[model samples]
Target: MRFTEHEMTVAVDTVARRLHAATRPPWRRGDAVAAYDGLERMKKWRLKVTAGEVVLPVLTALPERPTVGAKPEFTEAELTAAAQTAGRDVMEHRKPGAWDAMPAKRRDRVLATAVELTRVAVDGMPVRQDPDALIVPDHL
Candidate 1:
């Protein structure tokens, strides 16, 4: 999900413009102007893409019950034990696969899904205050 070269260029330009814009409130804000200058001086700023990583949130295809095709009906205790084992399996570690080596079409789909899930999770989060108010300074 790391942006392609073209995307990176556009994003950097947009961010630079926004930072420059932030310095222009009617207020006498020295810090805002300084920060904007500092950002311009930076030659490199890395933007990580979490969607590039494998092991994305899976919303389907849970394991089938262990007793699905059992020859004999299991006792209540046995069923309870199976459920506990399944719960523990959820906490097990699964190693990451080679996402970069995947086919372009498949990788695109996976990254797209990850981005959508990320958007949903972010949208559902609760904020203590309005973000715009905190990010932008008021005029004096």
Candidate 2:
């Protein structure tokens, strides 16, 4: 799938947050870090081996962006608490200025190049009804 910059950023950050949480001493027994790490690796591999139509399995890997104009799900108190938790997470674990260093266009371009390289690689493989389909892992 062709992900927008916002979508990819949200996904990456979300995963990073979960990773951070899981790595803490109290949460180390849980599976969140392993799952997110696997997903991140899978995305990189899929991006490396698909062309033209890059349908990533990450469609369900991360939460969707909250819709605008939707009824609020949390009371003001709950929202405030949640924000405080997230802010703490960000302040300590998130790499400072990582987002600024990677422009969305550059990331997309890199993905595009990977797809192009996959197309070249697939040319020599046995023809299939859908060349890209071969790249999608059966286990998603």
Tens-place lDDT per residue, model 1, 21-128, is 543675755665355456533332321222212111221112323232221233344433433333233334342334434576875554454334333322322332
Model 1 spans with C-alpha error above 4 angstroms: 1-97, 129-140
**Model 1, global lDDT:** 0.36
Residue pairs whose backbone atoms clash in candidate 2: 1-54
The residue ranges of model 2 lying beyond 4 angstroms of the native Cα positions read 27-140
* Residue 34 lDDT in candidate 1: 56
**Among all candidates shown, the one with the greatest lDDT:** 2
TM-score of 1: 0.25
| Local accuracy of candidate 2 as per-residue lDDT tens digits, 17-131 | 4334444576456565465465666654443333222212322222333433231133334333333333334433567655346566874554444333332322222222332
- Per-candidate TM-scores read 0.25, 0.22
| CA lDDT, candidate 1, residue 59 | 15
Overall local distance difference test of candidate 2: 0.39
